[model samples]
Target: MTKTLLIGGNSAIACALKKNSDREFISLSRSEGSLDLDGDLNELDSIADIDGLVYFPGTINLKPFAMLKEDDFVNDFSVNVLGAVKVLKKVINQLKEADGASVVFISSVAANLGLPYHASISAAKSALEGMSKALAAEYAAAKVCFNVVAPSLTNTPLAGNLLKTERQVEGNEERNPMKQIGSPEQVATTIDFLLNAHKNWITGQVFPVDGGMSNLK
Candidate 1:
């Protein structure tokens, strides 16, 4: 009977969550359901009964610092960070009314570690991770939990270019101690765990679902 709102469902992570999650899932995206990122999120009103929410929009603009443009950072920040904030802002009342609702944000390993051509997205993702923790702490009293997931290279459409080349994919898979890139389904499992009653007491945490990419060499 638990209703959940997934802000971005076109992505593999959201799809995976849809298949794996036990709660009622309402997918919201710019593609299918509703994704008016720069527009009003009034469409979200349909899911007034949602007890959990997850934001899955991301920008994979990996450009070198010198080659990066102002618009690139703006786009990255808007989608990766500000966009989520906007949606949540509009729907905060629903979450508060639900009481003890959980919020999840998807981040990348680049948020913490450094990588060439990852300037814009990395910074934006870092802001997301930090903001999630801050909100988690502040909203804990209201019984609303917030958390971020920082995963390594996952085989998703968002990173299609990076995973297209044979060498790029191979190198990335090797970079993780697990010797493989992550899958959307796997990350979805983690997201599912965090958003469920199983993670009731945990909050203000950034979970690295990376294939040991953040820690291992």
Candidate 2:
């Protein structure tokens, strides 16, 4: 059985993955019902072997660069970058113990594409991508693979404010080349693929699950 560790259990994408996945899932999140990563780092030490890890915690702080404060950047970084770093450090050994482990970090298309009102999140995710690549190279000898999945606006609780109304949804859809808003299931499937044994050969890659928003004009 594949042993998978997922952070941010309450996240829509994480929920979708958990529902459809047949693998053994160990969820860590701040939600009252789940194992809290913030409460205990030692808890991760008990996990024997981790075949796959998916960090789902992320922040979306959209604001004009002028209006963005220092705390805005710091807060986003804390959740998106530092949180992943802490979790990975705690479970690195378990990942190394597996024959070939896969680590997937959720990123955003804004990290690569120039988008308005995305200063804070873009910066944080860009740093995350860089960190993932560096760790991927460092852990290659251990047969631990690290990769990132960058998705555009998906229909999720986190993005509720962005898609609150029909006009808002239509606006975002029209912006994407696919003329549609992405679904959590769509992004979740891509993440599921990355965690599968068949993708052992794939590593240090950044996959854009966005509907051509990062590439197409």
Candidate 3:
């Protein structure tokens, strides 16, 4: 079986992916281990060769532009961009050793869409998307594909604050073109497909699973 490392694997989407996929998944999470995004990632140095990796760590720091501080931007970038960079550096060789491995990142539609109170996260995720494309080009020679899955208003604990009230829920749903919220499985399927890099020639692309919110009216 192909072994895939899931950073922030305890997340709803990651857990859904692990539960439904036939591939072997090894999860690392802050809730279960010392896997702090801003802390040492030395623990990942012990991992061996793996077929794939999916980064699920992210932040939902939403606030008005006036209320946003420099630290807000820094924290968002640390978790969403720097943390992934660190994890990738640790396992790039293992992925290359696999010869056709893939790396999937969890992004947000906010990165592409100009949404209110999303300045910090949008900037961070946008940087992440740019970095993924660069990595994909840098490692194409090694056949290590890098891709991203961007979802909008997903029904996950990370988004509890946004979905706390019925009015908020209805408002969010109405804003989407699909008129509904995205589920963990919906986003998971996209990541799962990208993880099979050995079977597909896809690379350096951002796949939006955002119910048409990113592109459509």
- Give the top-scoring candidate (lDDT): 3
Instruction: Give each model's whole-structure lDDT.
Output: 0.83, 0.87, 0.88
Report clashes for each candidate as comma-separated counts.
0, 0, 0
For candidate 1, give the lDDT. Answer: 0.83
**Candidate 3: clashing pairs of residues:** none
**Winner of 1 and 3 under lDDT:** 3
Specify the poorest-scoring 10-residue window by lDDT in model 3.
31-40
- Which segments of model 1 are wrong by more than 4 Å? 31-35, 38-40, 197-199
* Residue-wise C-alpha lDDT for candidate 1, range 2-21, written one tens digit per residue: 68888787789899888876
Between which residue pairs do clashes occur in model 2?
Answer: none
Residue range 1-217, candidate 2, lDDT tens digits = 6589898877899999988877789987765223245666667777776789999988878998999999889888888888898898888887888888999999999999988899899999999999999999999888889999999999998899999999999999999999999999999999999996325588899999998888888
| Root-mean-square deviation of Cα positions for candidate 2 versus the true structure, in angstroms | 2.3
Which tens-of-lDDT digit does each residue in 1-217 have in candidate 3? 5589999988999988988888888887865223265454676677676879999989999999999999889888888898888888888888888859999998899998898899999999999999999999999989999999999999999899999999999999999999999999999998999998657999999999999998899
- Which of the numbered candidates is closest to the native, going by highest TM-score? 3
Clashes of 1: 0
- Position 102, candidate 3: lDDT: 93
A best-first ranking of the candidates according to their lDDT comes to: 3, 2, 1
TM-score of 3: 0.95
